[model samples]
Target: MSKMTGAQAVLECLKREGVDVVFGLPGGVLLPLYDAIYQSDIRHILVRHEQGAAHMADGYARATGKVGVCIATSGPGATNLVTGIANAYMDSVPMVAITGQVNTWLIGKDAFQEADITGITLPITKHNYLLRSATDITRVFREAFYIASTGRPGPVLIDLPRDVTVDEVEFSWPEVELSGYHPSVKPHEMQIKKAARALMDSSRPVIYVGGGVRYAGAHRELFELATKINAPVTTTLMGIGCFPEDHPLSLGMLGMHGTKYANYAIQESDLIVAIGARFDDRVTGKISSFAPRAKIVHIDVDPAEVGKNVRVDIPVVGDAKNALHGLLKEVSPKARSEWNEKTETWKKDYPLRYIPDMNVIKPQFVIEKLCEIAPDAIITTEVGQNQMWAAQFFVHKDPSKFISSGGLGTMGYGFPAAIGAKMGRPECDVIDVAGDGSFLMNSQELATAVVNDIPVKVAVLNNGCLGMVRQWQELFFEKRYSATILGRTSPDFVKLAEAYGAVGLRATKPSEVEPVIRAALATDRPVVMDFIVSPAEKVSPMVPAGATLSEILELEWCDVAQSCHLEKIYAEGRKEVLGQEEF
Candidate 1:
């Protein structure tokens, strides 16, 4: 083993793990680490804020399927990374955030810039470390990456004190061996068979997919099982890209803002072959009424998540990939023609549509144009109405094509995430589908993109207010517009983009949406297209808060007949459409 400073050992360990890039900001405490970074071959993208650094890393991990890394200084710097860390954790994105602490001797004394980062990030991180000694640096770095990338991947943090970085130590990479950290990746034979039997027996089966399927990279297996069993597939928001939306069996998304037909299909199904999914509250509105008729067969890597939110008739605790493999072997091909016909009718009855008004731009129209023009772009979204619109309009034909903050629903996440995703896969085009309010939260990242020459395009849905909140208030609170509108105070997005040395374009009319999006996609320099969409436009196919799927609402603008809400099949269609097949 060769002797080196802890800072050098950090770089060496990263090299061993095949890490090529990192996103971070430097401070006084990180001097030694930054010095080592400067001398090393690893590419470091300097970020405007520690939060941007964390999000960029998260985006990088999601795009490349590798553990993304970021670094920051102590106190405020470490604290700035908290939201991003939590975003990654809630979404199960694999990341490792490194922060430099004050000298070890100054540890409980509350030295300047000192804060307990380990304590702050405990709940959000899969695991974290506070370096005890310089000698432990090698193992810490090694284990941090291992933990971050494996077993239902999530963020992990490493706190490096200044003294530890400067200390000299002999570095030797040790084999990772935790006493009780084995993740169940292989499913039990009996459990897989039982799940297979349940799935095969159900007449009306629906596959409910989650982000776990994306993490396990089991889309092929998932596809095979669904096709073999002749089941319709509905995905959660996080599960959007995992299943091909263009496929005949695909039922886009289901839940509060999901497609009406998907929600209908789920409610009518007799069996839910759930794969890598958690029954989040948003996906299961009014829990008692959710899938009231369906028995569940859950396959997941974490045992705790299997029955945490919903009851499971057949539970297979293992990685989604392995479990799917086992199910594929046990189950044979079968055609549920009656169930297929019902899904098609549901799809036709409640298609996602809107009035074609050339007067004002609609967010959904813009997203559809972007998808048509740049079908292969890796799309990331900032939270709000824009997030929902992207989820609804963009047809994700492949896995990893769409990224967003699903659980935490953090605003200001898309732009930086686009930057990180671009860095990880420079060959692919990256676009941030953002709402104006959410875009402004981290708008300063435009400078980061310009300086680094990262040409990540952004489509800003400029509704002139917090669109989602405004919709909620209008519907439920008598339109008492509080701190939502950024009317007169909103900055001119074109000027803002120009000031940051990036190209800016604006589309006010419906006719300009497609051309503007095409222009942004064509530009080599970073471009932000501000589509001045109508604030009056709202996301349809919504199941109101705490309401059952049977009570879904739609806007008259969506249908040619000016329909306000479509009656669910339970009342009039299911029995007639499916020849008396009852759930």
Candidate 2:
């Protein structure tokens, strides 16, 4: 076996594991690692902040279906990554976060920059390790990647003490062994059969697709199953893009800010075929009344999530693709014509809407135009109004196209994520749909993009307030408007972009929305398009906190309550794209 330093082994292992790029920041204890990085062929993206590194790694993983890697120093650097790590954990993104630790002898002395990162991230990570020796480096790295990419993919951490990185050790690719960590790839035949029966027996069935479908690369399988069963499909927020929104059967998205039709469908269905979904509160409001009449058939890769949130009548705990493939083989095509008509009526009657004021640009309209013009751009979103508006208005036609902070809902996720996604797929255009409040959280990353020559685009829905908080304050808190306003302190986004050596553009009126977006996209450099939008806008069809789907309140729905707001032209366009007239 060749003898090399632990830092060298880390790089060698990464090369053998097929990792070409890593996002990270260098610190004191990581000096040795950085020196090794300089001598190595692997590409390292220098992020402005450690948090951006973690988020960028997450975005890369989501875009490429490969394990993303991020590295950071001890103490503050490691702690900064907590939010992004938790975000990836909540959404189950595959990632490996490496952190430098204090010297082994000084670990317990609380030396400067020392931190117990493994203990701090215990609850959030799938698994974590604190290196004891240089020899353990290869085995630990292999294990970290294996654990992160397997069974319900999630972030894993490896805390390497400074001494371990510098110490020399014998190098050999040891066999990865975790006797208790077996992930079931093939599900039980009996469970699949049971699920098939439940799906076929019920006349009113809804297919609830989740993020697991995307993780499993099961979009085709999901498509086949949805069509074969003839069920109306609704995706959780994390599940977006797993099923095509333009498809007649799609109910857009379901949950707090979900389509009213989808909530109604869930309320009335006799059977729900939940594929690779965990029934989180965001997706299932008021669990007692959620799918009250429907028997749930949950399919997931992680056994723990099968019935954790909602009761399952049939549980198939295995890989989503395998379970879906098994389901496809057992179930044959069936028609529920009455059910189809009912679902269509719900879709037509309660289509997503906004009272378009021509004087100011509406965020939803901006998203609609974005989808129209940049049909092929990969989208990442910050949490809050921009995220919901993007979810509501954009028609996603491909899997792995829509990336956002689903579980943790980190505010600054989109911009760095966009940079990472662009790096992962350089040929495709990557855009960050951000709100003013969330954009400022990691706005400094503009320097990272420009300096690295990563030409990612950002569309800021600048409402001049914390949009979601303002909406809640208006509806629930009597519009007190205490700390929700950001207009007084918000930066001039155009100036901010220009300061970072990036192209900056703004759209204040409805007419300039398309032009600004087009111009930003036309630029080969990093571009930020700030759309000054109305603060009064709210993401409609909102299910109030702790309320059942039946209790959903649509803001504009009250205004257009008398008649359906859906246009004939929209359906015609959808048909033209889908290339079929009949549903």
Candidate 3:
């Protein structure tokens, strides 16, 4: 058999795995791998920071439903990838992270740029390896990709020691084997029947979808099941695109800053058909009180998540697509005319609202306009008010369209993510709906986009503060603003974009909102459009921390309480739940 260096084998394995592009930064021990990359046909994106590389890879994977690859060196370079690795793990995005380690001989001697990346990322990765020899290189890479892209997809790390990378080994592809890593692709017949029975018996049922629906390519099955059951569907923040937002069955997003109708529906549900969703605390609110009366039918690929959060009456541990496909056959079409009418009334009564200001632009208005202009665009968001507004206003027509940092809630995720999305799908329009605070966290990526000629657009809702934190301070802390205000140190975004050799535009008035967004979209180069918005604007339909979904507060709800001088919002929520007038 022909022989090749471990670095060359890595390239060969990547090519075999269909990896055409990778996002990463170069460092000392990574030079050999970088050299291999340079000599190969594979394209490598040079990110400004190692964190951006990880997020970019994540974004690409989310957009394409494929395994994304990212590389970093040892020490700080490997450490910087930790947050992004965790972000992928939480969101169930498929990614393989490669880190160059110091020589195996110097591993414990604290050599220069040495780090135990495998150990560092143990909790955040589905699996990780510390290569001891060049002979293990091919097997390690094959296993990493296999583990990363299967089951409940997540990041996998392969730590390559410098000596192992340069050493010569046989060039044959190794067969991947893992005895304890079998993921069930089929749902249990008995459990699926039980879930179907639960759905048919309940008049007030709701389908709760999460990121797994998108990861498993189960959107079609989810839609079929929801329609067959005639159940109201409420998606988690990560599940935004799993169901079409404009569908009659859709309750939009639920929990925290979720829509009023969605939170109310969950509070009143008798049966919750949770498909591929881990009942996260953010979605559950107070765990004990959430969906208090509902009998849960949990379906997930990961067995550990079945009864880990809320208890489930029927648990089907299998791939979401397969489970949902089987469920569609076992369940008969259900009709809950009364339940539908009630949810419709709630949706009409408590619609998402923002006051129109002729003097200044509203963040929601900008998001709506972008949705109108780019209806088919792939949208990404940083964590905060901007994320909520985009989730509320921007209608995602299909899965793999709405990408955001949901589980990890990373602020700097959107910009670099948009770049990766653009690279993954050059035909589709990609946009990052960002907050001023979050945009600045990785604004350096604008250079990466411009340099690569990736034409992704960014809309920065410049409220001159960390809008979400300031909103909380406004509501809970008696408006005692602390470090949340960013106006004093906020950079001029238009100037910043221009310095990065990107197109820059600003919108100060409501009239300029549409024009600015259109102009940004028309540009063939990377563009950053800064929309100066009101500081007082808050994402409404909010459920207070540690409170039940019944305690959702909206603009009108907040106004009424403020006028009545009420000390607690729970009192108002109690009245509403009792069918009393809200105001």
- Sorted by lDDT, highest first, which candidate order results? 2, 1, 3
Model number with the top lDDT: 2
Candidate 3 lDDT (Cα, 0 to 1): 0.88
Candidate 3, pairs of clashing residues = none
TM match of model 2 to true structure: 0.95
Q: Comparing candidate 1 with candidate 2, which one achieves the higher lDDT?
A: 2
Instruction: Please give each candidate's TM-score.
Output: 0.95, 0.95, 0.95
Off by over 4 Å in 2: 557-583
Question: What lDDT score belongs to each candidate, Candidate 1 first?
Answer: 0.89, 0.90, 0.88
Alpha-carbon RMSD to native, per candidate: 9.4, 9.0, 7.6
* Tens digit of per-residue lDDT, candidate 2, span 268-287: 99999898889989889999
Residue-level lDDT tens digits of model 3 in 132-153: 9988888888898999999999
Task: Supply every candidate's count of residue pairs whose N, Cα or C atoms clash at under 3 angstroms.
Answer: 0, 0, 0
* TM-score between model 1 and native: 0.95
- What are the per-residue Cα lDDT tens digits for candidate 1 across 1-583? 8899999999999899989999999999999999999999999999999999999999999999999999999889999999999999999999999999999999889899999999999999999999979999988888888888988899999999998999999989899988778888899999999988888888888999999899999999988888888889999988887888998899999999998989998899999988888999999888899989998999889888989988888898999999989999999999768999999888999898776676767788998998999999999999999999999999997668799999999999999999999999999999999988999899999999999999999999997778899778767888676766665226789999999999999998999998898888888999999998766678887899899876789954543121111112122333464566642
Clashes of 1: 0
